[model samples]
Target: MSESKDFLRSIVEEDLKSGKYKEVITRFPPEPNGFPHIGHAKSICINFGIASDYNGHCNLRMDDTNPTKEETKYVEALKDAVQWLGFDWGKNVYYTSDYFQKIYNYAVELIKMGKAYVDSVDEEQMREYRGTVTEAGKRSEYANRTVEENLELFEKMKNGEFKDGEHVLRAKIDMGAANMKLRDPLLYRIRHVNHHRTGDEWSIYPMYDFAHCLSDYIEGVTHSICTLEFENNRDIYNWVLDTLGLELPRPYQHEFARLGINYTVMSKRKLLELVEEGKVSGWDDPRMPTIAGYKRRGYTKESILNFCDQIGIAKANSMVDVAQLEFCIRDDLNTKVPRVLTVLDPLKVTIVNYEGSEVIDAPYYPHDVPKEGSRDIPFSNEIYIERDDFNENPPKGYFRLTPEQPVRLRHGFIISCKEVIKDETGKVVELKVEYHADSKSGSDTSGIKVKSAIQWVSAKEAIKAEVRVYDRLYANEAPESLEDLNSSSLTVIKDALIEPAIVTEKIDERFQFERQGYFYADPIDYTDEKPVFNKIVGLKDSWGKKTAPKQESKTESKKQAKNEQVVGTEVAMSDEQQALFDKYTSELKLNAEVSNIIARDEKLSSFYADALAELNSPVGIANIVVTEVARELKEKEANELNFTAKQVSQLVKMVDDKTISSKIAKQVFEEMVKSGDNPDKIVEAKGLVQISDPSVISPIIAEVIEKNPDNVEKFKAGNNKLLGFFVGQVLKATGGKANPQVVNKLVAQALK
Candidate 1:
């Protein structure tokens, strides 16, 4: 599916060209102990994807060596995850437990060759005997046992004559080996647990190291690809196969880094705990990182596959921004799913002047989407809009409805608020609006202009639904405990309203729910009487909006992957460039990765150097130069730029001196780009001074807290991610003039 070759694929391609084997064979061997997460998805894509690319076969193998932990349900889940990701394991599914007899026979042969022995050390004693990284272990006295004696004891042990921990089989490898795994590692462990497949047929089960290589050889696997954690175990993998004098075309293991996304956990133990402890509904909980979770949440197979391909393969472990995954889903659904109007938080509206109801034809997809199909959308005097669409005290850039402002109902008439109706509690329950008779979408004569069109559903014909909005599982970017679980990860809107065509027409299982996000009908729970839609992902890159200096809009984050993600075309640095990189990292204290990217681009490097000369704030100056200034320098030389490097330094100085926030600096930079004005003048004219005064920002934070009681509860319940939400809201309220640092402190305190 991809043109260029990763390291693993390169190996397979070379092996085939060199006639190393007649056909390439790979296997995805997951231990059936827990559900597979996104990490396993990466491995499955690699092993099965390479096989498909090379016209080979990939066997789906279950490495069920630990009977105590293995289960049949987990095996099925693993199989389902692979198939759901759109891959097939040719022929029959393979299980390592099926080869227990053969593996035991190989162990017997090793004993006959005086290369194996049975050790009778307790658990703590075994650890002590294995020695440390620096020290070498002494050979056990049992290593000197006769081959016949060892064979008898091994047979007796297998015959269930020994207790669970009485004895164990170990390869008589180098006891003094530096690699701890090679220091006569255990070939078999004693476990009285019932086997999921073999049942109680035998008391002995071969360990993973003793069985995996043999299973691969027995199945004629050519390339054994695995994650980096198994790199050290490769020696044992090879030692077992080579020492046995296995047939040619034996599998050779290759390692690649596993997938790791921030704000999520991939450990099976952690995931299992999440399921077993009822932290989530199940392993298939949409908030979990499991493959079934993603599928249940409405993510398409194409999106997950594209994510794996776009992230590419790497040799070193790295934490990917979850935003990359979000971008992939949005990109996939942008042109594929139908755009339907669904309001999660509905606000009722009554058109006072409009008299009659009519059905207007609305395209299922926007004009940008290539597909063409329209559904009947009922337009009535009474309709429901998103509660967030209307504001009593509208902000500076508020485009939705307000008392003094008019908004167009999507696919319907333009309406202005004539009155606001409230309940006894003083909450605005409904809006009495008057509509422009000729201002309907697609054809208008009254010449009315509204700020923006808001999604609405006819109160008479709208379908009621349960929309489950799922957020990330962890509050912390790098989670360390169960306490990091996001309490507000799942928000269920039981009374969500949607247009009739969504349920009656049923164009697709997945849909872009207008301004909300992409959603999928709950396969297990959806019914004609009760429709349950789970939000797959938001419309934009949420992690970006939350992490950026200011909240980025959908249009701003439209091509985040295109702008932020790039192939590491890290050209070999010249001596002069290397010196610059070294100085930037050591003397200037610039981030090494950021410095590397800038140092490689000649125009960016020159501009960065000039900016650095103007200001001693290496980090701040380098940031603006590489990001904003570099954006201009990309298509034009530094000399052709409107703003000079000195202007960039001045912008950084304003941010450093607390005269402006980084968010304000960004605005000032944009102004400089447009008019080549000094940042100081831009800040002065716009009155964009940093609001460091706690007196001003604290009240704003208090108002945000009052407005978002749900988020306030979430923050108190360990959902630290909501702190950004509160901060972004305050900043928006202040028209980006609030000091983010003060807002952050005040919000945390208010929420607490």
Candidate 2:
């Protein structure tokens, strides 16, 4: 895959091309107030990725401006996270406190130049006078102090002559400026607490707004990248740099959208709440959105970088679906990880035709994944398969282990369920199956064929281990306010049976537990006596199309290709199907394709007709039913899916009303196929509603233009094709839910 330069990287490319700076220098300045989350990971990648691409030095700076919440522990953890993400800061690692003297000297320079002043107002009075955006701020009584008087007070603040919050240094910027951040923001505050690294040398600490810009100046940084929330602060960032008269190559501030993934809160405060409330185990809990949590959960560092790259830099905030992240991990590990058999929910099976234990050589890697090695798996008369794989009273389309039905044992022989044994409560305890002697894998001669083939482990030799499964941390797609935190995010299967090979693997090993999901040997909990595994991601996407199964050659593969399910009602369509059959055959005057489909089953035909009847669009509904619905029915019956006829009406209505473009509607409908949820609920839950309203979309467009100034200029200079690029950017910002017509019009207006 080719790498696409993000807006930030594009800026670097232009600077390099235009000779704006000899070399690019960026920094990842984390505050060390809390553990790093996925949002911070994006920042780290952006900063380091740019510097590496430009062949320039990158700095890992600790912006420990506040001593109250800062600690050495967090500093160490942050460093570990950056290093684990595969970034080397080299020898340029720095701290803002390291330049305390220089920052203090710059503050004195500001005071001598009358650009900064000391204020004796109390904290309450200070905030009261700072005023809202609509109201102009009132100047402090102490703001008009003489330059010598202000200098004396500032020195006193540093020497502990003033108590905490008694006196502070404030910049002399406009008190009534329209941009609130420029309204004489505080330069320094009195903090009597001892610093973590500097100790009790100074009683006052520089505020972040003041220390950040000056530190960048002192370090000669070329560009300072921040999240969108800091865009308003950029004015103050420049005010400080210009007021201090910093030399050339002064750092320029740029803002990009921060990553806010669905199902997890990126706010440090909220993540801390989860840890403090016992909602999760700790910061490193596998369910946490923290980088450490991801590491503990078996996610590769490369996968995180890949995910960050996939979601490139944007100017407007949007919630990315968590499934995309899951896809990255699954894709990263798919071909590289070995395959194994693990029964999560076990059911006992007894082979009546087999007398003793027989060893079968099973390839450790699937044919799609190229690797050599086979493990001798001992198969006995008794073994275990997944409990859900068997059915006493089979459903209409159940294919696995019904009574008297033969199913192939993975890498073993074909077995037929002869009898099902039950305990006193009539609960099934064991299945008695007869195995065909000639049906052994690789040498099968039996002409019999079965639709189901399942993975199993020998009951006598299988290793017992605990497998921890994880779901999304929050039930809501956008947990903006912790609206719906999922209570059952973690599940532990205590008696999972795995092949013996899994027990001896290394701690960092990952494997595909056939039919289950990709799992990792729990690095923190694995033991030789009792192994533990963590489920990284499931094989099947619950919110989209089913991942295509691994392709297998019919000559060497034991698994059967999927076949369309036959409806149980063979004689006639049900009453529901009959009514739809009559409608399509007579009044609607549809073709044989519609009539033949509706004649297959009463309920299914009714489902198709109901969708068409509600939408009153035959061709559209017919294509959807013949294609999407038919494809889904291979795995489950029409009635078994969560999809409803009414949702189809809603989906078609979206296309008709232009609520969603045809492209986005297809995505919505596909999600409906996977989850069987309503289109409206899916749209609302996933933040997929179109942004046709100008008030909602104009700011996004303006920001996109502001971020990609070069591109906007080129578009204005006769590059009409860039119009599609801008439209695509808006679509991405809105998660592909923006109406194209509105976006095209608004983008043209903004460009003009």
Candidate 3:
């Protein structure tokens, strides 16, 4: 495989070289149940990206099988998302509904071959018959029906003779096989609901596993690519084709990790709920993670594509920190957008020593940017500066305007605060400042040095505009529910002051609001009468920790880490604790370190014991109790905990089942702490299921490596100590959700 090509591209290139069909045809098959999000964007990029790279063609297909929820609006949304990302789906868009007849014909073929049966068992009974993972599923007695009888029942189902769930056509793949999906998986089910496209033409719809492969076959899709969650379905994908004696060189299934961003929900159901529940304005709410949301929020298509390119493709699934995403917008807009003055929280500043107004010619683009555009910024004696720019009693490293510090009004003359005016509430409402007449921006003669230039708008010429400052929508990095909806997500500065040039002159839609954030002219709300601007993104600090205060000071944390030792610490455990730890490690197979931490505390041990009683998972239970439950226990007694042992046990079971990752379990645990909600409900509510198929983490890992080349070179030079640093970097990038094992292995190989 070429170094530049990802695994999917590699597959495409090899297939084309081997003459596995002349063209590399792929499809972006999205079910139109909800608006497409960035996850869909990744799929769009991949399917179209592969096709484009190989000089092939990709078809935009709507797998609109489930008519219960699918809507024309969602279908239009899917199309919009694809086109907005700058891709063409050829002349005709495909719909699975269009091939219903062909799909039904294939099902009839399966029945004629005695490979499928019409099962009359109820939905509940079918589930029970599917059985547990360890135990083999039992075939329904209805499976004993002859092929002719089954065909009659299926025809009845299609003719709308059967009610919903009365009967389902199941593939006769396997009953005692370990892969339970093949345990007579449903080929088709009768749904009386109306399909968006098909209308009342068909009452029975083919299952995803049934229709997907056949659709790919009919479409001549060379490579059937999907997210890792469908890895098991690949078995069925091939089985249907192999059983049917389909044409040679049929599409082969391949899986890639789906994109998952921290602090956002990607599940279409959850997103739909958010839209329906009025938590957001709509699917296109600027705060939503949907492609339309990002577009409405002023994210350029180029930036979105660049982010997809930067994140790259990976094989393992993991949570990606939203900081990396935020960084992408900042990086993209830094050079492309213009700079303008806008005060979010205006504090009136009067140049007491100044006389008249003046027009200051300031270039819209910063000095570093190569764009050529300048606007005459109106400056006068009365101006409005950001309230934050003037701290009455400044901090030690304060740089902006204060009683003592002198600052330059960006593109205008330097000013010194002479007097502070306050209202009855003691809030600094205004500032009286003196300006240096000769210290104009272009021709400065004053020898005084200022730390920074703050943005300001002339009170007389300032346009009254509403600036909506947007923050991360979810309060928790892994959102739990409406409870996690950030209260400060949308803060509207109704009367923010901006330089008149933006309103008067013909300027670009997006602009960097001087010291605040990238601002977009609100496409839906901006007008001459009522100017509105949406904050696209804030200027990211170097490390991107919410533009944190003193978080960049890693010295103390490093010193503490060196003292405690990252490998292991000599944790003091009682004799009773020691004995418990020994039993946990030796008998229960718990990690020695986790066992030690849990056993060291009587309350934790008690909680751990109760959880163990509920579910006999020693390692999983002990890990959470030690790291997470223990922390909560540190501040409160066990009885005071919001959650119970049984809840913790259920959480561990989810981890054991790979339903959620251990890192995600921590998130669920936090929500559990707040509301004492059951772990399962929390997971479902938050859509906290882990997305395996790790390729999404690859680009982030590469980024972490690139940002710390010194550590990379050191690791290559045999300083093995840096391995933890690299792992930590990756973990931090993933909000501690990237598989540590994967990170350790990937980092080691990359450094080599």
Top-scoring candidate (lDDT): 1
TM-score of every candidate relative to the true structure: 0.74, 0.73, 0.73
User: What is candidate 3's CA lDDT for residue 369?
Assistant: 56
Assess each prediction's global lDDT (C-alpha) against the native. 0.83, 0.80, 0.82
Span of 10 residues, lowest total lDDT, candidate 3:
564-573
**lDDT winner between candidates 1 and 2:** 1
**Candidate 3 Cα outliers beyond 4 Å, as residue runs:** 541-752
Count of clashes, each model: 0, 4, 9
Task: Give the Å shift of residue 184 in candidate 2.
Answer: 0.3
Q: 378-411, model 1: which lDDT tens digit per residue?
A: 8889999988889899646566799999988877
Per-residue lDDT tens digits of candidate 2, residues 1-752? 12335778778778778888998888889998888988999999989878876778778999988999899978988999999998889865799999999999999999999899999888899899999989999989998999999988898889998889898899999989999999899989989897999999989999989999888877778889999999999999999988877778789999999998876788888888888888888888999999989998999987899899878889999888786788678757864777788898888999988897878988776543446777788899989998877888875655667885788888889999888899999988999999999999789899877664688999998999999998778755557555467655789999999988777654238988876778988888988698899988876354322112335343222222123222210122345544555566345645333454545544556677678767887655654565456555645766787787778877878777777776677678778877878887877887766778899999999888887798888988999878977987787777677788899999988998
Give the 10-residue window scoring lowest on summed lDDT in candidate 2. Answer: 561-570
| TM-score head-to-head 1 vs 2, winner | 1
Relative to the unseen true structure, what is the C-alpha lDDT of residue 561 in candidate 3, on a scale of 0 to 100? Answer: 35
